[model samples]
Target: MSGGRAEGPRNIAIVGPYLSGKTSLLESILFATGAVDRKGGVNQGNTVGDGSAEAREKQMSVEVNAATTVYLGDEFTFLDCPGSIEFIQEAANALVGVDAAVLVCEADPAKATALQPWLKLLDELDLPRFIFVNKVDRASGDVQTVTEALQAVSQKPLILRQLPIVKDEIITGYVDLVQGRTYVYRESGPSELIEAEGDVADALGEARFAMLEQLADFDDHLMEELLEDIEPEKAEIFRDLTDNMQAGNIVSVLIGAAERESGVRRLLKALRHEVPGHGTAAARAGVDPASKETVAQVLKTYHTQHGGKLSLVRLWSGSIAEGDVLNGDRVGSLGQLMGQQFNKLDRATAGQVATLGRMEGIVTGDVLTGGGEAPELRRAPRFAPVFALALNVENRNDEVKLSGALAKLMEEDPSLSVEQNESTRQMLLWGQGDQHLKVAVARLKSKYGVSVETEKPKVPYKEAIRKGVTQHARHKKQSGGHGQFGDVTVEIKPLPRGSGFQFGDSITGGVVPKQYIPAVEAGVREYLSHGPLGFEVVDLAVTLTDGKYHAVDSSEQAFKTAGRMAMAEGLPQCDPVLLEPILQVQVMVPNEHTASVNNLISGRRGQILGFDAREGWPGWDRVSAYLPQAEVGDLIVELRSLTQGVGTFTFEFDRLQEVTGRAAEQAMANAAA
Candidate 1:
C-alpha cells in the first residue's frame, strides 16, 4: 500500500482454440519456473491444469484453472482457461482479471481463422497480448508465411521476435532477433547458446532488421537513426518495445513447443522484461490505483467437494485478510490457489490472485469497494444462448433442491441461464452448446447431489376452430330432495388469428337470466382450455342465444353444467385445426458461409426473408428467416459445423401458423405419447 507502484505479480491468462496446446503451454511454464519437478501429459490425465474428473475423462478443460509461481523474484499467476468454443464464457470472464494474455495456437496458417474472434475480443478490451506459435517443431510452412496469416486477424501490428533455425528440414533452434543470439532446443536439459556468426548470420540480420522496423513505427528517433545509416543502441530499442507493448500498440510474437518444453525459457525471459506493473493494469481495468481503499473483483467462482465456495478474485488495491468484510460478507478464509489445491495466507496484497472462501452472495464479475458493498461494474453485452434443453430430475425428490444448485451454477458462469416456461410447463436450461449442458449436468451430480436428465423442450401448440355451429343441450336430473333442469342454445364461431377468446350474450326476452350468464361464460372458458384437438383453444368466439331455466331449480351450477354440455356438442360440429409457433430468426455468419447457412434454413423447412451485411462486424452477414419452433432444437449444432463454430442467431416468437397434412398428425401423435 504505497503511492508508487512496484514490479509485482504479472497475472496472465493462457487462451486459444481447442486442441491448440494451451494446457501444454501452462504445464511447460510451470515446470520451467521450477514449480513442478515433472511435466504431466494431457493423455495421461495427470496434468495440474485440468484436474477435474470430468475434464480428465474428456481430455479437455471445462473451466478455468489457476496456478501461482515465482520467476525472477516476481510472483506470476497464470490462468489456464478452456479452449473449446462451447466454454468460451470462461475465457471471456477470466480475461477481466488478467493483466495480460498469451494467445497460443498451432503453426498452421489455415487455423488462423480460429484466432480471429479471440484477437477481436482482446483488441476491443484494449488488453495487451502475445502470440505463442506452439508446435513449431511440426509446423507446415516457414515462419514468415504463418506470421503473415496471423497478422490478418489481429488489430494491433504483430512483431515477430524470433525465427526458427532449421537443419535437414527439422527446427532445432530459434534466433532471438533482439539479442542476436541462437539457442538450440535440447530435450536433455537447458537450451544451449549457439554462435550466430556461422551460415545463419545473413538470415539473422534480415530477421532482426524486420523486427526493428516494426518497433520504429512508434519511435521517430529510431527511424531517423536508421535512415542516417547509424544503428540504434540496445537500450533505445528496448525502450521502444516496452513502451509500445504497454500502450497496446503492438503484439510481440514468440515461438515455442510447450509439449517438449522447447523455447520455454526464452518466452519467460521476454515476459519478465516487457510485462507492466500492477498500476498500469489497474488503470487499464478502469480502477484508480491511488485510491486508499480495498478494491477487488471476482473473475471466476467454484464449489469444491469439501472447501465450500471459492471466489477467485484479483486484488486491484489495498489488502485483504482472512476476516476482512467484502461485499457485506466476512471472508471465512484467505487462500492462494494452485490448480485444485489451496494454501491459506495471512493476508494478500494488491496485484495478487486470491481465493476468498465461503462468499455466500458474491458472484463472478463482482467488484467490491471499501464499503464492503459491490459497486456497478460496466461490461460488454453478454452473449445469447444458442441451444437449450428441458431439464428433469431423475428422482422427483430432488425437484426442490434443483433450483439452489442451478443458482450456484449460474453464479459460476453468468452466460448460462434458466427459465421455467409456464406455457409449456417445462424448465429449460439454456447454454452455448450441448457440451456446456453436459458439463452442467456433471457438476449438478458431483457438487450439488442432484441427478438430472435433459431433452428437447415441448412446443406450446394451440388449436382454433373454423366456420360456425349452433347446438342446443339440456341438463335434466332428478334427486331425492329436489329436481334440476337447465337448457341453453349456444353459437360457436372462429375469430381472426390472435383475436383470443370472446364471449357475448344475445338472449331474446332474457331467456337466460343475467345472474346465470356469468356461469355460462365460465363453463365456455373451461371447455376452451382443452378443445376438440386436445390443446389450449385460441382465436374463437362464443355466444349464448336462447335458453330456458326454472326459477326454483336453475342455480348457477345448473346453468354452468348446461353451458359445458352445449360447448361439447357445438365445438365438435365445427372444423378444428392445430397452430404451431413460428419464430423469426436472424442468423449471422461469415460471408463465405452465407450460402451454406441459406441451405440450412431451407432444409429445416424455413422461409428465407433476406440477407445483408451485419453492422459493425466486418466480412459477416446477417440472414433473416422464419422457422418453426420444433425445427430449431438442433439448429445451433449444424450452424456451428457449417461456420467453424462462429455462426450464431437470434430469434423470437413471431406468430402462430396453421399445421396441416402430415405435420399436424405427427404433432397430435407426439402429444398423445
Candidate 2:
C-alpha cells in the first residue's frame, strides 16, 4: 500500500440514526474504491466496521471504525460510527477529529426525523456536512420529497447535486447537475456518460438550474449574471459550490442506492473536488505541532488480536517517528490502521492519521505534544452506565482471570466499569443498557476465556426511624468465676433528614465510665450498619441517657453487648421505615410522544417536576421528573418503546424517599426471606 498524500485527504464521519445503513454505506464506499473485492452485508455480519463478535451478532456498529481509501486520486478517510443512541458517544468522538460529516439519511421521512439530533450536533460543532439519501432504489418516496424533508431539518441550504432517473421502480443512473452530464450505469462496475434524451434531458436541465441558483448565493458575479438572464460559467458555478460547502453555507445532497453501486462514482468525484484535504485540515485545526508546538489528538483506541493495543491518532502538527521523544518519553512505534489490523510504519507525517503503537499512558481524547506538554483536545462524550449486573466467576477458581478480564474489558470500553461492593460482597459491572453490559460479558468470555454468571444487582436501600423511644438492655451472664454484668438506657430519637448518626454521653460522673462510652458507641454503630430491616440505618440519633457498670468483672465488651441489644430493641419500636434512593430524571422526547412519555413516567411511580420545550429541537420537549432508583432499571427500554426509540434521558441521585405501607413490608419480607 502506498502512503503518498493525495490532493485532499479529508476525514469525514458517516453518522445517522440506528439501522439507517451507515455501515453499509461505508462498506459500499470501500468496495467502490476497490479497497475490497466484495461488499459485506450488515445482515451477514461480515462488514468491516462491525467486525467485533458482539456487533456481528447484533448486526450494528457499536463503535467508531476508521478506514481510508483512494477515491478519484484523493485519499478519503471515512469514520463509520454507530447510529444507536446508546453508542452516540462513539459518533461524537469521531466528529471531533473529522473536518466534515456525511449525514446519511434513509428515504422515509419518519426515519429521517431520527437524524435531527445528529444534524443538531453537527450544527453546534460548526462542521461542514452533506446529505446522502441512501437506499434510494428500495425507498417508496420520490427523491425530491425526501430531499425537501431533509432540507427542513438542515441548518444550511441543501442543494441537490444528483437527480435519480427512475424507470419502472428501477433507478438506471443519476444526472450530474454541476456538469450537466448524464451517466448511466453499465452492466458491470463502471458508468458511462451518455447523451441526454427526452424527459431525462428536461428533468436534468431543471435540476441543474436549481443547483446553479443555490451555488450563486456564494458568488456575487454569478448571482448578477443569473439575475441578468446570462448563464453563469460552469467553472464559476463549481467554484461557488465548493467555496460555500467549505464555509458551511450549503450542503450538497446526493441520491444513490449504495448496495447496487448506483451513482457512487459521481459521489466520489464530488467528494474529491469539494471536501477539504490535509493542508486545509491542518490550517483549520490551527498551528502545526512540529513547526511551533507538537499537537496530536487521539481519535480512538483498539485492542488487537496479536498487535496488542493501538491508539489511532490524528497528527494536527509535527512529524512523529519511531524513537522520537514526546511528552518526556520516546515514541514506541508508528503504525497505520487497516480496520482492526495494524501495519507498522517508519513514521507518520503531519495532517495524517496514524496508529501510535504501545503508547504507555495515552488514552482517547488525549492531546500529546512535545516537551511534556499534553492537553486534552476534546471533551469526552457523556456516557453514563445506568444498568448494572452482579457478576461471579462460574468456576470460582478463575478469580484472578476474571479480574484480569474485567480490567481488559474496561480498557477497551471506558463506558463499561466494574467495581467490588464490600458490603454486598458482589462484583458489579455497569454499562449504558442491558445490551451494553451483555456485550461486555460476552467479550470477557470470548477474549479472555473467563466464564462468569450475572444476576440482577442489589439496590442499596436504607432504614430510618420515624419516632423517639426509650429502651433498656441488660447483659448479666454469669460464667464460672467471672460474672459479666452491664446495663444501659438509650434515648433513641429520630434526627432530621441527613443528620446521620449522633452519639452523646449523657452520663454524669462515673455512671457509665468515659472509657466504656466509646465501646457503647461502637456497638451502636455496628448495629446501625445492618439495621433490623437488613439495610443500613441513616438519619437518627442515639444518646446514652444512663447506665451502670460492674467495677470488678464488667468490661467494655459487656457494655458494648448491652448497647447492641438496646438498639435492636429500640429500632423496631420507633416505627422503622425503608428508604430507597430516588433519581431526578430529565427525559427528552418528540412532542408527538410527550403524552406517552408522561404516562410511562407516571406508570413507573415517577413524580413529575416540570416540562419545557427544547430550544433547538423543534417538536421536542424535555420532561423533568423524579423516580426511584429501583424503577430505573428498564426505563430506557420503556422510553424507547414509547417513543419509537427516539427518546433519551439523564438522571442523577436525588434525596432518599421513604417506602411505606405495602411496599416497605414487601421489601422487608423479601430481604428476610
Candidate 3:
C-alpha cells in the first residue's frame, strides 16, 4: 500500500501476555472516548474487545478484536490482541497493519520474561511501541523493580515517563516526569493535580533527570542543555520523547490500573500527542507516500454464520468504495467492526481498518491492490506447529462436512494446519500448542457446526526381521471341477536399516514358471504389509529359490497362495522385531534453563547431542538431541513449562531405530489393543 492518505487515521495494536488487562484497557478507552456509553468487564462477559463466544466462555481473548473511537478530535482504531502465546499469530498479523503498539503488561517482576517474545517481535518489525504497566494499584513491589525487569528484556532503552505515588504501601497517585507535577488519582474521572514537597519532590527530581538523560542520548541539543545545567522546557522534553520513540530508539513507559479507569486518560493523551501519524508508519513499511495505487493489507479474515467471508483490511493508500473491484473480485459490501457490531459504510478512506465482504480467496497477511500486481510487503513469520491432535468425526455422515469446515477455520487461522496421515489413516490438526488446537476445535463445533472426537495421534511403527529364513510351502486345493497345486521355496534376508523391501528371483531350470513366479513375489510383498507384529515390515529382501507346479492345475492364484503361506509360516522363524521412527530435535531456550531442558530430554529417552549459544540471541542456547517420535508428542508442552513459557523447539524425521524393553512391549500391546 502507498502512503498518500497518511493523515486519515492511526491504527494501534494493544498487545501483551495473557491476563495483562488489554481487553479491560480497550473497554476503558472506548468508554473514555465516548464510543460506548458504558464500559464492559471481561469477567462480566460484556467486554467489547473479546466479543466471541469462546473468549467470553474462557474469559480470555482467542483472536484479535478491533474497536474504533475518537480521542482528542483524532480518530483511532485499536486492535486488541490475545495475550496467550498460542494465539500470537493473531497479533503478528494485526501488528503489520498498525502504526504503533501499546504493550500492556502487569507490574510483576516475575512476568518480565513474558514480555521478551513481544519485544523481540516489535524490535524485528522496528515498530514504535510503548509499555503500559497495567494494574499498578495492585503492584506488590516497587515500580522501579518492574521497569528494571522490563528493561532487561527490552532491546531499546525504556524512558520512564511516570512514577507511581505510594501512600501506606498502596499506589494512590503518580508524578509526571516531564511535567514535574504530582497528581492524586480519583475513584472516577481524571487524576487530580497536587503539590509535591520534601521526599516526593526529591524523588521526582531524580526520576525526571533519569528520563531526560535517556532522551538526551538521542538529542544532542538536550544533552548539551543537561551538561550545561540548563533545565529543558516541558515542550522540549516531549519533543525528544516523541521523536526518539517514533524513531524506534526508545520505548516510553506508562502506568495505570485499567479496570478502575485510572491513568486511562493520561495513556490516551500520550497516544494522541506522541504517536506518529499513519503516513510515517506507511513509509516505515516501505510504501511510497506519493503513489496513487489503492493498496491495502489483509489483517484478518472471518467466516460469519450468515455474512459469508469478510476480510478486515488496512487501507494504506487511496480510497475504496462498495462497488470497487479488487483483485478481480467485486466488493460486495463494506463496513467496520466495533466489537461484534457492524457499521455499514459506502466507502473506506486510507489508513482505515475496514472489512471487505465476500472476499472469498483473500486471507490474512495478503497484500491487496486496486488493480494490477500488489507490492510485496513484509509478511509475519509463520511459527511451526508444535502440537497436534487426531480428529475423528462424531457422526459418520459428517466427514465431508467436517473437511469443508476445517478449511474455513484454517483460512481464519493460518497458524493451524491439517494433514491426513497415510500410515495412521487419521486426520491430524496441528497448531502452536495444546490450547491453540483446543480453541480451533471449539470453533469447529461452535462456529462451523462440526463435532469431532480428538485424541493423541498414533505413532507410525514398523517391523523387520533380525535374521534370514529359508522355507518351502505348498498349496493344494480340491474343487468340484479340478484340483489346483503350486509349490515354491524362498529365502528371506534382513537388509540394513532404511534399505526398504527388495524382491528378486534366483530360480533355475524353470522350476517355477515365470508367470507363477511373478504371482509369488506379489504375494510375498502383500504378506509383508501385516507382519508377525501386526505392522508394516521393512528393510528385508526375498529371493525366489525354486518351486514345483503341476501343468494341469498350476495357476497364478495357486502360486500366490503358496507364496503367502510360505511368508506367514517362515517370518515367525526369522525373529521379527519392531522399529520406531526417530526425530532430530533442536530446543531453544535461555541459558539459565539449558540444564533443565537437557534433563527433560533424557527423561523422555532422548540422546542429547550438545548445546551452544543460540545464534543472534544473546544469553540463549540451542540444545540438539535425537528423540523417538513417540517421545515428541508432548515435548513442547513440557519444554515451555520448564523454561517459564519461553522455550520452543523444531523437529524432523531422522531415521528408524530398533525399539526394545518395556517401551517396545507397551507399543506392541497398544497396537494389538
Q: What is the C-alpha lDDT of each candidate?
A: 0.86, 0.79, 0.89
Per-residue lDDT of candidate 3, residues 119-176 (tens digit): 8888877899999999999896888999999888887899889999988888999999
Please give the ranking of all candidate structures by TM-score, highest first, separated by commas. Answer: 3, 1, 2
lDDT of 2 by residue, 118-199 (tens): 8888876677787888888787787888888777767679998888778787878778888888888764376788988999
Candidate 3 clashing pairs, residues 3+ apart or interchain: none
lDDT of 1 by residue, 11-106 (tens): 998989889999988888888898889889999998889998889988999999999998878799999999888888888888877888899989
Alpha-carbon RMSD, each predicted model: 2.8, 3.3, 2.4
TM-score of 2: 0.93
| TM-score: model 1 vs. ground truth | 0.93
Top lDDT prediction, candidate number: 3
lDDT of 3: 0.89
Instruction: Return the top candidate by TM-score.
Output: 3
Q: Sort all candidates by lDDT, best to worst.
A: 3, 1, 2
Candidate 3 runs further than 4 Å off: 1-6, 482-486, 515-518, 550-556
